[model samples]
Target chain A: MQDKPFMSSLTTDEVATSLRRKGRWGLGEVLFWLAAAATLFFLPERHLILNEIAIIGLFAVSLDLILGYAGIVSLGHAAFFGVGAYVAGIFAKEMTGDPLTGLAVAGVAAALLGFATSFLVLRGADLTRLMVTLGVALVAGEIANQASWLTGGADGLQGIMMGPLLGMFEFDIFGTTAYAYSLVVLFVLFVVARRIVHSPFGLSLRSIRDNSLRARAVGIPVNRRLVAIYTISAAYAGIAGGLLAQTTQFVSLDVLAFHRSADVLLVLVIGGVGYLYGGLIGAVIFKVLQDILSSMTPQYWQFWIGLILVVLVLAGRERLTERARFLAGRLFGRSAGAPRTAPAREGRP
Target chain B: MTPALETIGLQKRFGGLTATDNVSFRLEKGARHALIGPNGAGKTTFINLLTGVIPPTSGRILLEGADITRLCPELRVQRGLARTFQINQLFPAMTPLETLGLAVSERKGSGRDWWRVFGSDREIVDEVVGIAQRFRLADVLDERTSNLPYGKQRLLEIAVAFACEPRVLLLDEPAAGVPEAERHELLATVAALPRDVSVLLIEHDMDLVFSFAERISVLVNGGLFTEGTVDEIAADPRVRAVYLGESVDE
Candidate 1:
């Protein structure tokens, strides 16, 4: 055997530079955010729906942090969302009505809940996680329902008056202010979430999601990472909920409903998962489709949405996304490169 | 001096079957040891017990004289006990760069940092690059682990464990299913591990066992059958009788 030490031709600096470059923002990302900003001036009449889209998109992004990146399947994500809405609502009504303050208060409240409940998820498989998460949302909804004095119960928390943004821009009925506020909040939080997923902490979560046993073997405290991410995701969801309550100036029990969780999950299914853009793109597609379809057939819009989901699943989300990327690359004069799919998991020997 | 890893009267019973039967074993510091056994001889189970993958039915395990029988698997790894799976257990979606980065970052106590970019930490990146070069995985560092060849994946499996900088390494069939052309590289890397890290190789390949292990322990029916130096085991008739089913001369 050769006794000479093995040497790699690549320098550490070169590799580090390349990795750093990968995390840099591309033109597409810049254009995507610019287009979102442009909606304020270009589509004045659509501000209300656009505001809703921004809030939902933020919620979806929060879910992606745990579901897409960490491989945590949470059906009770709305638990945090509802907590944020109620906390913001009560904060505005009882404490302070400052929108940013309400958001912070709601985020912290949801984070505490997330930290408390994250332990339940550490013990189970996917199915168990789903059940536990679902139970958490259901239980949260019930608490909100039973505490009529605090939450206004089934009637929902009303008469919440949010102060102007930064004590300057008053919230207008046309939703121009709300859209701008929601958009800015979404962008800031998305930037933070973007940083998180590309961090070492984020990489460990992906490892746990892919194969937790090997993750543990590599000396990663799997449960702790899960707890931390779950808590962060909850805070994100809470912030999204706070946006919804602040924008509309109302809090509803529907925020904690099961359909909210199911809907956000469906949004991820539409956009793709793992990558951060999936949530944002999926939100736009989902909300727009709902708007267009519901206008055509209000009652059967759900049926059409369900059909689309079935089609997306049957045709394979990855293949469809690859095709879309290929088309986009051709249109934009860039090489899409070879389409890649994750290799099928190998069974144990 | 204390043994690197020790198991005292370790036993595991699965219903009516005793998989690991009262096996008390010790691997001295910096020992190059191999555990050999027949099919279903409880080789993997013993490693699992030592790594704390599964709790023992009774008895204790120690790492460098520290009682670690009740330690969780990740905790054992934190305490400097690292292991590879019998099957290739790896994150299929992550590239080798990301995989090694995770290990190195975790070891350096920076795995929980969410604010900084992953490769922004120059120290961790340098170590990851060094380890990747040492394992000959620098070329495929950007390739997804599942996309790499079986041989390279196997190397990565060991590379990740090595990244932990463990005091004692347990390699479970590291060469299993590797092709003839790739087997030599795998075994060479295993043989070339740092001397300060005590290694316990669990393998069915006798050639690898003989070439790499200075000391050999034979396991039969979940119990320690015999243990001796390479020459002693090579000349033992009872070991042959158990392995080859040959009649023993009285």
Candidate 2:
């Protein structure tokens, strides 16, 4: 047996290098984004579906920020999404129609609501959080339904006219511009979220998630961190909702519906949680499955989706991913070996 | 100088049972103190009250002469009070590196910086590495914490608390479940803790308590039974009857 050193002799630079390497963007990440961008030219005819996927993907990512990292179970996430949708729609109709400005306004509005409701989440366990979140969404939907003059009530907010993307690209009927706009917004926010989860702040959040008692023992202000992440997640969801409003040129009561919250949770489950990319990956699979199944059986498409969910849950995500990695490693050989272990251990950053 | 940690007339009652009964305790600055009592003697309860895990029924806790009875647990930690639990309260999913990083970063007030990557700060990395080495966890720093040996996990429990840079450290039975071979490392590390940091050790191991503590406080039935030096406690027959007599038989 080799003798162990009394102290680590590793230089600061070496330690820093190893630490930075953990957060480095891997080739898989680059390839994933490249494929997303390639959809613009390769899948132009499917831009409408692509636009929807981008918006929902962003929404799923927002939920992942709170549920995945902070372990805050929010069932009323759609409350923020709905708020963003209405705020952007109104801002475009009554204020300036600039898509970027509308998105900003909507995000701020959702963040405010998130900040206010964040305290409610701090007081409860998982069950309480779920109830509170669900309650918030229900209340939001009812307000949108009753406030007919302002929100168009159950009729839905209509005639939302959005200005060009960056004062240039118009939102066309084919959704080419809308897809591009949503994709960019998703990418930017994804980068920010990525940065957060990789940071010390993010590390503290994971600690809080794993064991709040120890987190507090170590001086992590658990409640404050939860509130911060919830607010930021609210902003992300709001932006995603704003994207939907801008791209579709309409806001509906369904945006704040309970189904929206459940659907986002389903998306996270499909993609896996804690890791950021699960939402994006889950969104792609969910939206595509919805599109294909809906075409085949428009009335009973949800039955097939539910079936898939059951299979996915019963089979277990970790086992399935391991199997996928084994197959990919066999196909690609040595190149996939290192990357597999990296993500398997840490879950992808 | 004020006591590093002081509990004035601390009392805790769980319904009809009095867990801790009106006890005033002080851990002097830079002192090596041991708090020993048999199981159910309310040693853990006293530590819990000091750390603000559960509020005392009626009492005032002071850290460095400032009243901290109403302060929350994390606030106490922030005020340079740190502790290890009787049962390890570690993040099972995190590695030792990440655990130390969290502790150190939080101490340096960078735990809230969401925009900056955790290891991007050179100082934090250096300190984490330093703490890992000091605690003999350098080799297994990257390994998941749950998979670590019972001894290393205990070391990590101390290492994380040490990383908080606390003025007073409460170690609750650090050697409880450690096997014989690993006890040396655990004890040596405990002995080698910085002198400037006051240590209050709570242990059932008479050997560790006797060797490590300059001053000892004994508790019985949730109240202070006796206080003395090592030799004085060793000679006290009442202490032996209430506590050490059972340990000697074991």
CA-only RMSD, every prediction: 3.2, 2.8
User: Whose TM-score is greatest here?
Assistant: 2
> What TM-score does chain A of each model score against the native chain A?
0.94, 0.94
- Candidate 2 chain B: minimum summed lDDT over ten consecutive residues — where? B133-142
lDDT of 2 by residue, B1-250 (tens): 7999998999999999999998999899999999998889999899989999899999899999999999999999999999998899998888888899999999999999988877999889888988888899987888889999999999999999999999999999999899999999999989889889999999999899988999999999899999999999999999999999888877
TM-score of 2: 0.96
Worst 10 residues of 1 chain A by lDDT: A340-349
Worst 10 residues of 1 chain B by lDDT: B241-250
| Candidate 1: clashing pairs of residues | none
Give the interface-residue alpha carbon RMSD of model 2: 4.7
Query: What residue runs in model 1 are displaced by over 4 Å at the alpha carbon?
Result: A1-4, A7-9, A335-349, B244-250
**TM-scores for every candidate against the unseen true structure:** 0.95, 0.96
lDDT of 1 by residue, B1-250 (tens): 8999999999999999999999999999999999987878898889989988899999999899999999999988988999988799998877898899999999999888998988999998888898888788988888878899999999999999999999999999899899999988888888888899999999877878889999999999999999999999989988997863432221
Error of 1 at B217 (Å): 0.8
